[model samples]
Target: MTLLAGARVFDPETGETTRADVRLDGERIAEVGPGLDGDQRVDCSGGLLIPGLIDCHVHVAFRRPEPLPRSARILEAVPVLRGLLARGITTVRDAWGADAGFKHALAQGWISGPDLLVSLRQLGPTGGLGDTWDPAAGAVDNYGDPSLPDPLFDGPDAARAAVRRMVRAGADWIKVGASGSMRAVRAGVDVRPTDAELAAVVDEAGRCGRDVLAHAHTSAAVVSAARAGARSIEHGTFLEDDAVAALANAWYVPTLSPMSDTEFAGTHRRSLRLAVEAGVRIAAGSDLAPRPHVDLTTELRLLAAVLGDAAALKAATSEAARLLRLDGDRGRIESGLRADLVLLDGTDLDVTDLPGRVRAVWHDGERAGALTSP
Candidate 1:
């Protein structure tokens, strides 16, 4: 048993803070209240206690810029995984690229990494973002590993089949490129999956008990995806009034870090404001590839700019866990839940400053390694 003493606990659900002591037994929280007793006591005076941060979109196994062997590529991803844990991200939803092996390794304690909800690969039509076909070269770009699915198809029938393939490949969630890329191909945003195709993908994934996450950045794509019953829209970059109305029943994940300085930054920021005003559930996602240059802290700071500090903190904690359907097992500082928690150095810091203030972290009741600024 371990007791964390004298810390202010932040309740994500109520946006309130209270001083309490939390006791851990094995892999679960035994109790939470004032003056808890345990075999091991750790002083946590003048600190903040919050649920471990969860990143909804990350590509943990993204390959290096230069060519490398398949074995080397997998090996190189280890440091990035460790880096995420060190910076206080206890859970991550891999948008694509990470395979089931990574999750299994973490479960068995073979490697150090955040708990993973992997999508395996992204599905889309030919010539879209997931296609990677070069007509001039007469070949497709190799992703270095053949174990992952090839996410390209043409019609509704193929779309249904692709969902089954992803399920067989061990996908926890199905990721589809509903709209075009905003960076690589500006023309791609104008192109998205047809309504029929999108519906088929959602239907098949539903039958397999998996939710579909649509990569949408344009108004047309957002409306189409919402109508087709996608669980969430990945990046509503060009969301409009019509799109907001269409998303009345869905969640929005505005990945703003990569576009923070781009020309379209203000447009998406405005879209976020509209989404908030319309009562849309907003979740935080960096849409970040696990690389040396990316930062999840920057993503949280940007979200704070639009949704205030408390709301932005909820976007990454309680709200993100709800979006991933893991709120029951984690995401709160209550008893009878998994002991996934983060400790910050101060009690008076704003919730948005969590990543930078992390002093220690605990994953599944075990304290992780040395901490670092995000």
Candidate 2:
């Protein structure tokens, strides 16, 4: 048992801020009050305690320069999970990875990382963004190649088959590339899956009691995915006004931070603003991959710059947890939630400057003890 006292607790759910003490028993929050008592105590006299952050979209096995082999990618999960926890992210939803066993390992305490929620390798059509075979490299010469597992389907039947395969492989959710990606697709112009195919994937996912997350970049694709019942739209980069309204009606997640620094931000930012104004739920995700420096704090700061401070904070914490469907268990500092929290150094610090103000972090009621003074 442990007690964290004298901290300004930020409760996103109630929009409440107060000096409080939080008690932790084992891995859960035992109590919260002004002067809680416990077997062990820690002073948080100059800190602010908020819920552990959740990253709705992430690629844990992602590596730079060249894609790593399946075995190597799986092995990197330990360090990646540790890094995320050290940054105060106790939960993460991996958008794509080699397999679900990696996530199961973390959850069963067989691995060293935060609780992982994985959508094993994204599903798409033939010649889609996830189905690249470089014959010249001699790396992906066979089907189910560890280096290049084809994330492709031929049609609706194929799409349904792919969903079953993913479920059988222990996927918690299904990730489908409904449209071509600017960074992942080259030569082939951007194309979206047919309505029939989208419907089939969604239906199959529903039958299996799993949610579908769509990687949609264009307006048409976003609309199609939302209408087809996708749980979240990974990157609604080119959303239109009407599409934003539809997203709000469907309660879709409009993930916008990936394009916050891109050249397309000139147009995408406006769409994002409209989406927010239309009451569509916004979630924070760094899509942190191919670049190691992009952490949750950096993503939150970028979001604040694009949106406002309040929206950014909500996106990073409460909204993101909602998207991941973990709001009941995490995402806020409350009496009956997990004791995963982060302690920042200042109360008067600008929200835009959050990345530099992370003084300490705690996961599962234990201090991270890794962060140094800013």
Candidate 3:
């Protein structure tokens, strides 16, 4: 049981904030009102209390390998995991390269990290966006993990089989590369799964009561995925005018970090604003590297620059939960929701410095993350 007193709590659902005290009991929020009484109280007098953030895309078990051995990279991901929580991210949806074993470890207290929603491994065709084939390094999936799924399927039957494989492996979501990688493929963005293949994957996922998220960059790919019933387009960077309408019913997670390269910086920024103005549902995902370059704050900061403060906050919090199909369980500071909270000691609840200003964090009503000051 814990009490966070006198803070500005932002309601992601309403985009309104108010001053109140939040009381937690066991693992759920007990109450949220002005004069809530509790057994243990922490005076967050001038702080900002917000629902714990959710990152819709991350690759926890994969990162650039240098200086550290393969196993060290896995073990050393602890700090980055802690860094995520300290920065107020309490839940993460691992895009790929994470297995069910790792998710169970986070749930069972074997690891100190956020509540993990893992996709196990991304399913894609041969020589596609998720292909781990480096000319120099033969067939290494994200630094020599052969267990990662890169099944090549030419028919709808094969695609359905791949989706079932992931579902049987305890995947929470089925991640598919609907478009090709610019750097990896000679055909560039034109490399995409056929509409039939996308339909098969989506069909299998729907039958299992799981959602499918597509890594789509081009407008054509985005349109195809949305038509095929993917829950969201992971990197809908090049959405056209008509493509924007396609995403009206689907969430668009424009992972701003990776696509900020030379050819995309200005246009990608413009497309983000267009997506918003065109009534497309936008969610936040830092496609940031996991180990050496873990940072969720920059994504929010950049998102705020494009979508203003309140919407930017929603991109990271409640809206992200909706994209991950976790709206009912968490992603709010309500009385009955899971008590995943982040208390900030800062000037205000701004996106840029909100990560650094995290005063304390609570996951499942238990104190977690870095408490900079008592």
Candidate 4:
């Protein structure tokens, strides 16, 4: 048993802040109150504790500084995993570029990292975003960048088959492209697949008891994907006011990092504000591919500018967990939930200052001291 004494706890469920001693037993939180009895104690007198952060969209299987062997990539992922653990991100949802192999490895305690939920592979049109190959460019990948494996599909039948194939591969979720992307091989293409194909992917995922996240950028695609029952819209950078209506109950993970420099960044900011005003669910996702020891707080800082402190914090924690279906297990600082928590500098710290304020991290009720970032 361990006692985290005298720290202010932020309740993501109620968006309330209270000071308490959080007691941990085994892997769960045993109690949260002013005076919790425990065998071990840690002084958290003036620090702030919240549920461990969750990155709703990450690409754990993408290329690193250089493409190495599979074993080398796995080795490279070790420190990356450790960094995430030490930084207090206890769970991550790989939108693409990851497989069940990583999940199983992490589960078996072979690699120390956040609990990973993978999408296996991403689905798109033949020459769409996932497949950066351009026939006109003679088999060249014009994008010259790292992307998840592409499972291209043509029709509704093919879309359903692709989803089943991924589900069979132990995918926890599915991602379907609804709009053309920056790396789309085809010129002048905005929407990638037909609406029927997008809906077919959703229908098949539903049949398998899984949810599909739509990689949508345009308002048309966002609206279409929401209507087609997409669980979430990834990078809805161009989503309009009416699109928010369609996504009233669905989640919108605007991967702001990738778009912060593009021409649509302003539009994305406006869209986010509109979405918030229109009752669209906003969850934080960086869409920042792994670069050795990169800061995980990038998106949170960007999100905080649009959302106030508490809303931004919840966006990265409880809101993201709810979207990823892990809220019931670990997103709140409540009893019976996993004791994945973080200790920050102050109760009213700024988001941009979080990297320095991340004084300590806990995973599964214990401090990951050895994995602390230098």
For residues 1-374, write the lDDT of model 4, one tens digit per residue: 99999889998757778989999998899999998888999989879998999988887666555645556655656777777777778888887766677888898988788888888677887766666565566554422323233367899999998888888878889988888775442255664788888889999999999999988888888898899999999988777767889998699998888777778789888889889888788888877474543344878888888987788889888899899888888889989999999999788647786767887888998787645543
Which candidate achieves the best lDDT against the true structure? Answer: 1
Using lDDT as the yardstick, the better of models 1 and 2 is: 1
The candidate with the higher TM-score, 1 or 4, is 1
TM accuracy, model 3 = 0.92
Runs in model 2 with CA error above 4 Å? 67-70, 108-111, 135-150, 183-188, 249-257, 353-355, 369-374
Cα displacement (angstroms), candidate 4, residue 261, comes to 3.0
Report the error of model 3 at residue 119, Å.
1.2
Question: lDDT tens digits, residues 1-374, model 3?
Answer: 68889898998777888989999999999899999888998999888888898888887666555645667657655666767777788898888767787776777877777888777776777767666677896876554544445455667888998888888778899999888864533344356778999999999999998899898877888899999999988877777887788888899998887766557767778878889999788888887563345456777887888888788888888898888878888888998999999888853657777766888889888889572321
What is candidate 1's lDDT per residue for 1-374, written digit by digit as tens? Answer: 99999999988888788999999998899999997899999899989898888888888887666767777667766777787887778899889888888998888888897899988888988766677777686555567465588788789999999898889988999999888787644754345678999999999999999999989888888999998999889889989999999898888989898788789899989999999999999988888763454656677889989887768878888999999999898888899988998899888637555557888899999999974332
TM-score-based ranking, best first?
1, 3, 4, 2
For model 3, where is the 10-residue window of minimal lDDT? Answer: 182-191
Q: Alpha carbon lDDT of residue 80, candidate 3?
A: 63
lDDT-wise, the better of 3 and 4 is 4
Whole-model Cα lDDT of every candidate shown, in order: 0.85, 0.73, 0.79, 0.80
Q: In candidate 4, which residue pairs clash?
A: none
Which is the leading candidate under TM-score? 1
Rate residue 276 of model 4 by lDDT.
89
Q: Can you list the residue pairs that collide in candidate 2?
A: none
